[model samples]
Target: MIQNSGIGRVLYETLLYLLDNGDEWILIGNPEFLKQLPGKRNTIVASHAPAFHPREFVGFPRRIINSADVFFTPNYNIPGGIRVPIVASILDLVYFDLPEIVRSPVGRWIRRYFARRAVRLSREIITISEFTRERIEYYLKPGVPIHVCYLGITRELRNQRADFLRGPRPYDFPYILYIGNVKRHKNLHVLLEAYLTARKNDFNCKLVIVGKMEGLRTRDAGIMREFAQLEKQGDIITSGYVPDNELYQLMAHTEVLIQPSLYEGFGLPPLEALYLGRPVVLSDIPIFREVYSDLPVTFFDPLSVRQLSAILENHSWETPTSIDTTLKSRELDYAAAAEKIYSVLKKYAG
Candidate 1:
């Protein structure tokens, strides 16, 4: 399936910039998804095999691999038997950092093995956040040069008009926004419980979660119980997948944006909200602090239902002053990011 958010979003923006600027890339994976990007000079080789599948070991067309000077994978799924110099991106040690997320022991082992393989095979490693860099150094101890290229806000968000008014209400009632997958580390179950508690305390806003909710019941039974209860009562709304413009409208009109993830390499929703001059409530995790401490944002303990509930009910924080100006001058452009990565590839390119 085509991934349009998170790591995929980051890759898409970076590749788009590279293609527009000047680069001949041999793209792999789903042709339908990749063919949308500009640059006919770049080659698009269709491969149906998904990442980490056994077929991926030999799935990449030999001619395509042979033509490449250097191979850079956005994620740690390094293809097997490639002779070219490889540069792999370890976005975050999600599997290694949160082992329990993968229920099967063998599955956990496979993840670890591939992660290490990516480290061992790659000529260099690229990660998005300083927090993730520390995690890589401490856990993996990769001796190769590891570069930190902080992810940039996508062009879509950056180019959005400064005075972009909130359009029509995504929902009639006031709602708080949360954008991301329902992954285990996302701590969405905790968010639901806190939202439920806030509701009891007279918080009169709906909880709007924007993401795909398919198979969440099987993946997280505990969260599903809370989700079902709130959803049945119409207190929780799930927007399966919203386009960029619709997402911007939702973000702009939100009462407040909340990110209650227990762990993250770097949280993008809160960053986008801050850039949009929207009030944001973030989990008081190390990565959030390292990346967003300079910005004016409310931080809360992810494990504390009462604390989050009180904040949600009271609505104490105000929209940040001078945030758009601050982010515009900072690490918000993906073109710079693509240039940084391109320089690295040029160094190692044969």
Candidate 2:
């Protein structure tokens, strides 16, 4: 949990689960941050480099660790750069999925290098979804076992009331919501194009894009410029980083949540929409089909603006599609996921 990103949130959930289920757990990371999390009695802030990279391969400061058996990192690499037996969770191989986003030859090579190193050193690999596991197998061919675990819905969702109209709204009229950051691989331009095309058919819905607006790494300037133009026209509204309570309520009331991402370890928006009983229009990707097989979600070709437009035109406030309430995600499977992790750690823990 080096920073406040999706991966950090996932790591926080892993920490919470371990605290409740496992005994004698240890957390190793940045002191000022990881120490802020509960269970301080078990935390150890070993001084590592400014960032978590293979610079650790240069040298791992191990004088701090007293004794440890299995190194369990909720993320790809363990803190202090332990190149030994461990259970490491790799979120995505998106660099391989969308190579154009990699930007640098050396950066891609280093990522591949670190991924192979992480896989080779680990006793087992944990992926967020079966899609990610297959992706890793396709690229790395690491002989270690791969485990798939799904994330649970946020606790804030449970506190959701039917008072959405009472809360502050990002837009006055009906809107389709898109959560998460704007990144190159997200294929946001496709959404904008589709939204514009659908508006011609009187779709009558503003597209609300929500996430942290400032201090973001812009991977594609072209898409950012397009977004700015759309925002100016009021075709799209950007509600930079709404709080969880408001976000979930917004999801509950939105016309439909759209995820046009080209690649994802596990798309949480649709899953969160699953809890909110909101229909999702997702990119026709294998991972969504694999994860939300039971959930009835509209699929669209991510590259084809026509297909997305058609899906949007069909979904409108006047003729709203019935969201299947039974279409819930396997979020409750966290206990089983934790158990599987615990079993693996217990086997290797000496």
Candidate 3:
């Protein structure tokens, strides 16, 4: 698993829950990595293949798979030669929904083909949000049941400390936080423009972007120009990648957390911030509304830089003393999600 990714957190949380429940299992992954897991009873099959690799499609050990009553994966990609009933998770349809962001035509084709194939082959599908479930129904129109099991906060985020573990604050000055990468659909450029406009209006807080910025390339030239200028001018700071402890501090201390995504399966960062009693500004998209309408959050049109800038300048963002709503009563935690997922797997295993 890519340790810092949103989906990676989901996989880890679900696995932890499953292990705690003490079900005998056949796990597939790097042996070294699988050994680190808590469960001693699990049969780990060593497969060096990464997700979507050609080796994964054909190189999965048949004997190990055949022994299992059900074959389940957190992703849509299915391993070949599995005789058991399959239950797969289709997290999002972003690749099919937004083609312009997909640089490789062949990569897009591969994703579409495999996703469609997984829908056809799976006994049932699990998705994170109702918005994504509807998208699946509209685009793929699957024959099997599609279950909407909302994701939960990671263990790290849930058990966060009040003081910084690293012994110092990330930044001495106030900053607005953005957690995801600079993907085109993330609408980071609009955020940059809004930040610039906010600066002009005397909202002088810096912009701190928390993600890996090693190959920070965006197709939009205007975005690149604005980003370069702000970064050079010391108005924007990019923390390449920080561990969960440090990330909790960053999220905790920020003036506000903003997620200006044009599309998403479930926007986890802002939700994490909300859980911490921090104020959030999210894009006025269907998924954000579906997931966060009951929470204490502000929304703005994703495309309107002026409106966002104005909000940044004018809005009074107070960290709520208490968050009464339980994130729409969805049991937005891994235990519930894992229980629901386990029930589905067991149902199909019969």
lDDT of each: 0.81, 0.71, 0.82
Give stretches of model 3 more than 4 Å off: 2-4, 161-168, 214-226, 316-321
Off by over 4 Å in 2: 36-41, 46-61, 78-84, 159-170, 212-230, 316-332
Which candidate model has the greater TM-score, 2 or 3? 3
lDDT-superior candidate, 1 or 2: 1
| Model 1, span 75-140: residue lDDT tens | 887877788888888888888889988889999988889989999998899998889998889888
Clashing pairs counted in every model = 0, 1, 0
Give the root-mean-square deviation of each candidate in angstroms. 2.5, 3.9, 2.3
Which one is best on TM-score? Answer: 3
Choose 1 or 3, whichever is better by TM-score: 3
Question: Total backbone clashes of model 3?
Answer: 0
Q: 241 in model 2: Cα distance from truth in Å?
A: 3.2
